[model samples]
Target: MLLHYLKSSLDDIDHLIDLTKKDIEDIKEANHELVFERTKIKNDLVKAFENKKSLLDNELIKMVSNNKGMDLESILNEEQKTLLNEMKIKLTELKSVNKQYAKFVVIVSEFYNTLLDKIFPRELEGYKKANRTPATLLKVRA
Candidate 1:
């Protein structure tokens, strides 16, 4: 019964790891969205001009153009920009957190495997040691 309870506990931990992995995936997706939003905002900041049009397709620029909101600026105000910039920074931080979460998931998975290995080392070793098993002969006297 104690062994069964321990196994159940490990299964619960595995489930927690699964849930944490999902959260990590969600953080990554949110980070991608934030990056895209930042790019779009920066592009809008510059796309209204002639020579600045080249920056739109580069996919590498980081700064919003100096052109402050004269006409198109009404679409997003200073407060909105500030909020988005803050969110972008937060998303970046979350990405770093997601990296740590990934490492934690790997450690948890490895720990479970180690525990299972300890419980069945011989069977595991046998599978690793040989691809084929030698046949055993039996002698019989009648």
Candidate 2:
């Protein structure tokens, strides 16, 4: 049960990391609709990952209870330990990639906000940011 959960949890995280990389590319290409479309998938993956992690944790706790005094690392066999180490490394990579993606998103958002501000020229009232109205498209017949 322990090894099964361990492997499954690892797989879940790997999928999330893959999705994150793909999302970064989608953003770079300004395929925002695709990015938004993937959000539900990403969220589902995250929920599944969390569930696997919770199951893994329960299994680990049960092992500790059965053996008494032994910590998680001590109880894990070589294979389990290896899988845990791989998860740690992958998690680090995930954090790095997520941070990079976050920065890119902030830059894109700021660019759009600045452009809107220039176009709309918001009032300088006592608000932190300006309120924006919807932009309209003009269609003319030839």
| Candidate with best TM-score | 2
State every prediction's TM-score relative to the real structure.
Answer: 0.35, 0.87
> Distance (Å) between predicted and true CA of 121, model 1?
3.7
- C-alpha RMSD (angstroms) for model 2: 3.5
Best by lDDT: 2
lDDT of 2 by residue, 1-142 (tens): 8788778878878888888888899999999898888889989988988898899889888888998987877888899899989989988998998898898899999999898776665665675655654443323457
* Reference-based lDDT, each prediction: 0.44, 0.83
Report how far off residue 131 is in candidate 1 (Å). 14
For candidate 1, report its TM-score: 0.35
Provide the lowest-lDDT 10-residue window in model 2: 132-141
Counting only residues 3 or more apart in sequence or on different chains, how many pairs clash (N, Cα, C under 3 Å) in candidate 2? 0
Ten-residue stretch with the least lDDT total in model 1: 56-65
Model 2, 82: alpha-carbon shift in Å? 0.5
